[model samples]
Target: MIIVNSVEEFGQRYHSAKRWRRCMEAIANLHRLNPGVCHSIGDSLVYRLVDGAAPAAECFTGNRRYVEIHYYLSGSETVAYAPKPGLQRLAPYSDETDRETFSGAVAGRHAASPGQLLIFDNDYAYQLLGSDHLRKMVLMVTIEGATFHNK
Candidate 1:
């Protein structure tokens, strides 16, 4: 898990920091583009516009196809995160969704404030929640051999 206070921090932590920074700069473009439109820059990298009201995420899920870099531009939320070790399975992984649901105790709570970036690895399970609003972009970077296919 890579947690950074700013995009620069993100750049320092990840190899594709410059590429991720471009995605950060394109938040406005995300608003202009319709939901589900791929902001594809190159192979294995892209971002889709994502936004929702309070309690934006409820269930705990982890991804297999991509590393989830959640950069919040506005609003705030609390994320419950736990290592995916002995977590009980709520649902199996679906290739279509790239998520596996789990039910267990979260070890920590992360503050998802504006300008803060949270990156979850493929095996980390987390849930996002907030009081009134939680708007952010999910920059999905597919791992080796995996690509985000839009349907």
Candidate 2:
């Protein structure tokens, strides 16, 4: 499922954990750093900031073992997503990368802007499209069973 919410709302939902709180704190300070930088806040929790020209076309990717939380920091973009079954595999999911590339028609598109957070689970394939200068922070968290574990 795809969830579009404010970053504050996402923090409220996952704030109980110390690691999540740390991740939230790091997100708040991401603006101070330059673009094209990636850092690991904790085990299974990665923080990535992208600021540059958007992709030329939609390249859908999905993960089976991780949940992705994308927060737009500046500019704007459209996120196109489709269910896994509707996509044709371009690359198989890898345990090291935790991502599988796919190509297909998107089910829908969401206009994303600053302060907006888009959450995607393992069942959906998503692609970011259409932006001249998009600045966003993505937090990829590994999930095990029903528990949300960072390490």
Candidate 3:
């Protein structure tokens, strides 16, 4: 997991990621945006805009084929993070949605404000617990390179 505090930092680290570069370009083009699918970079990448209250811990979500970047455009939010080792699954994994919700004791909660990004890898489960209102963009990229297990 990585917490990026600014675009400069995110660029410095993940600029080589083509999908992430494309997503940033699309975000720059949006002057007037709504709450929905903003852009699809390709089959391996997707960018979405979510404006709503974050769900509960029972609704914790994890992905197997993708790593996610949650960029808080405005407002602030917290997310619960835990590894898959002992976390109890709430439902079966959905290939179509690429999400598997689980419930268990979390390692800790993380908070991000505007201009901050939460980067989650494929092996860990992270839940975005929201506030009354939050505006954030999520970039989901297909899994690639070294995983946590290998390191």
Candidate 4:
């Protein structure tokens, strides 16, 4: 898991990285495009604008094929995440959608506010908790050059 507090930090962290830039550009396009509409840039980058009330409780989700990044555009929320080892699978993972659901105790929670960016790898499950005004831009970038083992 990686959390960037500002865009400057993001730039400093991933200086001139093409994949990261592609992800950032996709997010910028989302800001220019219609709300709640999903967009994709090549096979590697998928992004969308999400605007709605957050779930009442944590609804943990994870993906194996992509690294998930969330940039808060408006409002605030709490993000809860935990390692997947002991989590009960609420829904099986789907290759078509590249997502799985889980239920378990979160290891920690972070207060997410505007201009904050959160990045998560496949090893952890996470959920967002917020009020009716929650809005964020989400990007799913394919994990490059990594092999996964099927259990």
lDDT by residue (9-101, candidate 1, tens digit) is 666665455555555566546657665567876665678755667555657889888788887878887888888885788988899878898
> What's every prediction's RMSD, in angstroms?
3.3, 3.1, 4.7, 3.3
Candidate 3 residue-wise lDDT at 93 = 95
lDDT of 4 by residue, 27-85 (tens): 55764866677788876787888888766664798998999998888888888899988
Residue 132's lDDT within candidate 2 is 91
For candidate 4, which ten residues in a row score worst on lDDT? 142-151
Off by over 4 Å in 4: 146-151
Worst ten-residue run, lDDT, model 2? Answer: 142-151
Q: Which stretches of candidate 1 lie over 4 Å from their true place?
A: 15-37, 145-151
Better structure of 2 and 3 per lDDT? 2
Runs in model 2 deviating more than 4 A are 145-151
Against the hidden true structure, what lDDT does model 4 obtain?
0.82
TM-score-based ranking, best first? 4, 3, 2, 1
TM-score of each: 0.79, 0.84, 0.85, 0.87
lDDT of 3 by residue, 10-100 (tens): 8788788776787677567555566785577666677778888765454668888788888888888888888877689999998777789
- Give per-residue lDDT, candidate 3, residue 118: 90
| Pairwise TM-score winner, candidates 2 and 4 | 4
Candidate 3 versus the native: TM-score? 0.85
